[model samples]
Target: MSRMDHRNNRRKTWISRVSQYVDSSAGRISLTIALISIIGLYLYGREIRNKIAGVPTPSVVFRDKKRRRVLIIGGGYAGLLLAKALHHKLRDAPVHIEVLEARDKFYHNVASCRAVTEPGFGKQLWIPYDRFPVFVRRNCQVTDVHTNYVVTATNEEIPFDYLVLATGSINSIPSKFPITTASSQAVATLGRIQRSVAEAQHILIIGGGAAGCEIAGDIVDRYPSKRITIVEALATLLPGRAVTDEMRKVVTEKLARRAVEIVTGARVLLEDEEFELSGAGFPEPRRRVLFTDSGMALDSDLQIVCSGNLHYNGHCLQKLAHTHPTILDEHTHEVCVRKTLQLYDPMLPHIFAIGDVANCITSKTIVACEIQAKVAVQNLLVLLNAEFESGVGRDDLPARLKALVQVEPLQEFGVPGPLLFITLGRSDGAAQLPFLGVLGGWFMRRLKSQDGMTASWWRQLGYDNVLSNT
Candidate 1:
């Protein structure tokens, strides 16, 4: 009786399992089809966009016998990078290249903010113009880049055929590498910034973007005892951006923990000897402080303006974005290049714009700049070879909007890519990988950023190993 009962129970169990599998078959099949459709649509959409974008037909034959004359202007990350890509691509060919860079070295702009905290890296950040091949402009500045030659402030006319304008953004810091020239004047500027930071007790940093936030963190960490306050013009510290809530929380928490006060949703009115903000996130008025439409003074002992990059004066150097329609749009204010990244202008057939100099940017971090550099190089190679390619190049948005914007993403070097991994004092910090909602203390800062900060460009410039040995 027991054996018969056990056999009957086992048969019932097998029947139940078969019914469950049968019921789920349709759902699984539907899920698989949906996945395939999404991928196919993405690829098809990219192809359609490329065709609509209309890439330039290459003039230089990829395997041609003649040498390609490529002229790169301004040797920051953009110029140095393009030079490297050209080197690798034209390794076997006789490529006549000329890179026009003012000053002797490429200043590490990202690390410049870091210098406010750790004083040691300041001098090391500048690598001489001799680092890269072609023409070196030691103690020089670009006056003009006409159709045939590059004119310098010193009136030196260097001739070229193809042009790449990668002159990065200009910073106000003196010794920090000025946009033009290498002289005693730049030295005075560096001396002044250090003196200002050294003398101040209450520091006010305006604009909580990457520069402001990192600068605030660096300052507060370095001068722990100082009264450090950050006034963010936006409603939020890292507002509207896709940074992880945890990264924002961690950064806010870290700032609060260090007694660093953050005032969000305010506008800066004056950079008087004393720092001032309008309707600054503060509600009340303080005695002995002026109040405007915005709010009372943040009472800054020292004020550093991270008020975004100055673009108007940028043209005083080389006329880059002027002729290239791909750099910027005349009507909609968009990047006019295809995913292949060729400018809308028929003139700049194979060249591209990237890094801080890139227009229509939402994220201006070095991470985004690096991604642009890599893609610009890859796409440039394709252009040189008479083929078309596509890329996703959106900054600071969700994948849904990212798909809506639907540009190939440039590579980011930082860990998590949202919560900036930076060292405060002795490299103790929290980084928010907003994309992953992941947060960790000091791992990203010390490892990915601080220690991993190898100047890979040194090899490209043919300097680090060779220069060190000499």
Candidate 2:
């Protein structure tokens, strides 16, 4: 044997010994322990980072013999997040937080446009409430809200020490599902809409707001050869205080690039028009002519109404109008809330109104809901920990409630500012940031268009395993 052969033999012996050790039981146990230690360290580091960033973490909750009930109406984003935050903060306190939602599943309406336009996408958007960390009672409709209790549709009165009204608004289909819509029905509705869009050659979308633009964009993206028209009563595409002129121009241009026709300063006459074909033997939809106020005759096979005919879900508070006239806005029918997100009525200091239901001076968006939820949680905590005299009137208890925090309109702390991202299609979209100004298709695609942030939401609600299976 030469020197080189000897060196090779020594190297092979070392490899064989290491391989044999790795295959042994003791080595396997050591590897498992090392893996678990690494995972434990990673989780610990993540917890510390979350704490420093002001993110709430779930803790082991201890139940007291007598627990105070906290009832939340509408288990949408606002109500669900509020329940989670309260559960985290009051883990050791004798408090039971419950959310009452009419729908069986939590609908991610942010991606609703794509859900309607694309097949098999709706399933990911409809998340089951069973996986939610806090207690959420589904299919429970709140018929009325009283001072200390709420009346359910089933005629059961649920008493609560504190109540949160988060019943959001009801928009047109695809933008929002009906309050009574179950998970199966909602999925079927989205499938029907997808079929309708697929069959129609000329599709007309009423209202040039976010919903209309997104629907048109998604439809045209799926069916490029189809003619899609958007009609708005306003002069511009996106009309709101949050939308800048630059943002409007970019959205308009993006839609136009997709060959989506925009008809502004005109209203589609919806009354007394044969808008669709539905009778037997007419399996295929036929084109119908729709006249606008500006005498523009548009022919379309499908017409989607995304106009401002939204019904605010604050009517449940009408029962309290006899006592609190200003509880619900007479014009908008939105719940009138104070700056602290508490009910405007002094008699109902323990009741709060947040999200789209509350008449906050900001655009109704998820970001707004999140900011409002944080404020409501802070104020709720202050009230929960405060010492109140048994017979003290709410009006006289202002001194004790002085620590209640007020919401900063449109300002989510740690976030730059109000952010708006609109996806045109799978590959194209637009957005308006605080300091970044308006971004084009590339940025929007990477940010929201790919999976519509569905995975992030599932992960946020502690359903990461669902994503893996999907």
Candidate 3:
């Protein structure tokens, strides 16, 4: 072989060996980095999830002999829907559900303004909770709640693995609870209100929110000749943070057509003190005097306060608020919750809060309550099932424990545009569904006002065969 050919061959051999060595080293380094990246990412993801989940609570451990208890306080719309959903989700699971409600029946308070105005509709408003699938403890007022138990007013200690708080807001007069849940007793209380309205020549409603607007509509519809006035402290009727001038004008015009008067930017005095009722712009011949903070005076035979939602900040709730300020609103005392509907405190994963009592959502209507109930129940079911599976010697802790689902936040309602259903009376009303814009005509009355949703609610509560008027 020639010297040139031999040299060329020798050079090609050196280049081939260099290329092979470099390729092998690069492959090993790339493989090592990929593995490290995957492991680090997994660990980081777990840390984030753990942080979101708060503290790992072993409070829900299940003993083979004992049935797990899921205690719910307050039998309002939120509580009822949660109980029903949980029951269905864990029908075969070994768990006991209990509802502690002060009243024996579920009073549809949304229709309350209409119920008190019309005596006949009172019966349809309150229905017994006896038929509920779970155990219903009547007259059971929860005075305190702790990590794993709740204390009743009678000093009864009810143990629970998981606790849900749905105690709704307490309203003022006219929107107040009935004296009793018994049909007869409720009828008597409602009768007195009806009789009072019948005797009164003039009525004044304080607070121009939904309650005030509804009550005004009901009274004016029943007694067209009676003088009715709405005294709102804010500048507009239906004074929500997001309420628009157009929405306010719509409600104001409807009520005005019914000859109901509205006084805005005036604060009504809640004291027993009386005024001359003939001062300033008010007319003379006062039957009864009413005074305001704005120096406005009016005459009315009956006055109903429909302002403010009083929180039942019991000693236990207050204690919780003090310890976990992040989970409780300082001003409202309503429990702060995550989008998952679980209590915002990372340490209290087993405890959940919903409905008007939970300040996470903007709207406090039944629509919002139902949405919260579903989200809370699904996540809770996953939690409880994880605990159950773990107790049964499941090795996959991560997989089982990650069952907690998330809930998307709801769009804000009752505001800048239209997202509320306000009935003027049996014949006239307005409604606004998401994406549907504003709705009117007889459809609104037929949906809610005509029967006050008595039938729809009864059926939803598992009374399929029950009569509508019952």
Candidate 4:
């Protein structure tokens, strides 16, 4: 029991530490390889499927310099993916893709909840459209959409060979920035909101969905002293295909451990443009009270509405109302698409819709939007080929739309399986995969929330560095 014994123990501890490090490194390596393999197979299979479905490859360059104008309304995930795919897949092809977005930059809506709380991370979430190679007409709001043309707010008539409506959904202020907002302005808004939240002693978040839960987690983690509460309209938090019971339980426990209050089956009532909070015991000024339909009154110093976006069917539906009233879903208030992801009306084959605007029977998510963009792009390429082969112009192609002829219909967005992820904070989260029912905190954090994938998204959108652009 001397120096020799101590040296031996130290040597054994060092070996054990080395072994653990090696094991963790090996696991990470394996995960990386598996992910790469999955991505490779997905891209390869997609290319093969596109070829089988009569979509021209990148090598197929159209000789006719008479470029086809592809106009995309909305620069959300779906729209950006579609534009990027078109540019990459249809390289040197006779197609000119353009996006008309009201905003000057693409917003990272997924990370917005945390971004709002932590204003330092807000600017990282917005990417300027100019950073990408695709043509983006920022600050351009489409007043009306027609079969082959769109009228802008400025009374400009823009014609297109093909049209894509990826306008996405409209939500409240914090969830979605103002339509015509610039990146700097959006970041300033987040900063102001963050300051307000920091000053408030108690915070009430209405909605236990992803946004609400995320807001609670981020706020609680950053400001542990603040009292936080989340109220949801449904019986359980994040109901339906959003999250499983186990995931919900973990998140619920996480919030409970932080002493955050959660109220279910609560509906906020609006009176004179303000939440009806008078009947609550708490007096105004000192404490802000919120009245809910469930007879539950909550008091807080500050309130954040983490609710759904407003219906955005007004832009394109006005034109579709007369021609195809049945294209709109009664319950979802989303545009109904055929199996090909095209507008249900046979007359508008050149017109396509993706993302939240389309009723794909899946929870409105980025994963679904990406899949929809791929299908829509593939179909559009096929239609373009048909047009080129027939020597028909854009106007004539609609009448001979292949989907209408039943020769080759567009592929559906394909109902998305359960794929959900909810971050409790920066370091912890819960997720549900396709085959994997639910995943733990470490996995979810590493997969999504670590850097919020802002850099990854920048690379995906053809940018090398996000901070450089900022």
Compute the lDDT of residue 383 as modeled in candidate 1.
Answer: 41
Model 1: per-residue Cα lDDT over 40-89, one tens digit each: 44324444565689943233343324454667666776667667756665
Over 1-470, each residue of candidate 3 has an lDDT whose tens digit, in order, gives: 99999999999999997667546857545544554464344324443565688934223445454567788888878899889878876777677888888787787778778875787666677777767787778888887777667888899988877789988876654465632345557655666767777778888887889888888988888889999999999888887754455567778888998899898999988565332221111112236676899778877777766775655332356656667667777776688776776778756766888888887636667766776776677667667656665553233323322422221232122212235677777777766544444556344665677766777778766687444335
lDDT of each: 0.53, 0.75, 0.69, 0.75
TM-score computed on alpha carbons, candidate 4: 0.85
Question: Cα miss at 15, model 4 (Å)?
Answer: 22
Q: Model 4 residue 80 lDDT?
A: 90
Q: Candidate 1 at residue 461, lDDT?
A: 58
lDDT of 4 by residue, 58-130 (tens): 2433335477889999888889988998888777766788999888778887887777577577887888776
- RMSD of model 2 against the true structure: 12.0
Those runs of model 4 whose alpha carbons end farther than 4 Å from true positions after fitting are: 1-25, 28-65, 272-286, 329-333, 394-406
Candidate 1, run of 10 with poorest lDDT: 277-286
- Candidate 3 regions exceeding 4 Å error are 1-66, 178-186, 242-245, 273-287, 312-315, 321-325, 392-418, 464-470
lDDT of 2: 0.75
User: Estimated TM-score per prediction?
Assistant: 0.67, 0.79, 0.75, 0.85
Q: Is candidate 3 or candidate 4 better by TM-score?
A: 4
